[model samples]
Target: MSEYRAGKAGINAEAQARINSKYNDEIAQETLEWIQKITGSPANTAGDAENLYEVLKDGTLLCHLVNKFQEGSVKKINQSTMAFKCMENINAFLEAVKKLGVPSQETFQTIDLWEKQNLYSVVVCLQSLGRKAGNFGLPSMGPKESERNVREFSEDQLKAGQNVISLQYGSNKGQQSGISFGNRRQI
Candidate 1:
């Protein structure tokens, strides 16, 4: 999900040229400004914005955002299941782009940059709000807030196979007579 850089000479020079020409440094600059506004963060007039935007335009931004958002937002290990759900959405986005047609380097790179700068921050905010105590442990990397799992199970199914032990071992409270009758032999 890293940024995109123009590779060797074999790439369709016309296409690359078109992307470079159409996007230009100005587009990167403007997109960076937009990212700052969206995220409510300081502007990156520094080269960081341009560099990130290039990657966004390449079609790798979804993956990068998913991974980072997953890492920065998840507070516990069990949250991984939730993180995976978020990753699925990112995958869907990538699939949609593929179905449409490959994006121009400029377009993809710009989008990637926006995710890294703005969308990512939003994920972080969401993660903070969603955090809760968990029986599972935390990861070494960090919390992630990509997406939540929409998968659900029926309440009846969840209750099945559970060992509901009563605390009153010796007490007759709520005891059924069937077991007592079975214990007594018939005359």
Candidate 2:
């Protein structure tokens, strides 16, 4: 009897999971249709709708959605006097996040995700989130894209890099300290 009850519980959980998956797939299909309609682009039917969520939640997708909203501003459903509900939802979420004093990073990862994407209202978000940044261990100031430089290490630089790494970690590994080397690039 106990074994039967356990089996039934497992089946119930599996059934619920299937239902959720089906619901999400339906939503993704509807969203794809809306995206096509708004962007006036060819519809995408490449993969399972359920798989679209992973690709649709990035900075690139956010910018594309904003552009679609702008281009499709006049295309409205249900006796429209305003913008699309999708844009409204984003604004609403932004407002809610602002009121909670949450950092903009909580919504988007980097400042580029806002500035390069032209996501206005970031100033307000920064003001609100800045007040609570320290509590969350997040940096108060976001660096610009140009400042994020990727430098190719010279052969000498690589040796120096290894030395610096050795200084920090070699002590733990019972090794001698790193060889002293001068920096060629500014820290």
Q: Which candidate ranks first by lDDT, i.e. highest?
A: 2
* Cα lDDT, model 1, residue 155: 85
- List the pairs of residues colliding in candidate 2: none
The reply for model 1, stretches above 4 Å from the true place, is 1-6, 46-50, 54-187
RMSD (Å) of each candidate, 1 decimal = 20.6, 19.3
User: Which whole-number lDDT from 0 to 100 does residue 129 have in model 2?
Assistant: 40
Runs with alpha carbons beyond 4 Å of true place in candidate 2: 1-19, 22-24, 40-43, 46-50, 70-187
Across 1-187, the per-residue lDDT of candidate 1 in tens digits comes to: 2347544365665654544443334434443443343334333433343464343333233433322323432222221334345444444434443333323231222232333433332222222322311111322121443456697889887687365655654777766666664497455
Model 2 whole-model lDDT (C-alpha atoms): 0.39
Writing each residue's lDDT as its tens digit, candidate 2 over 25-48 gives: 443444444444444433463334
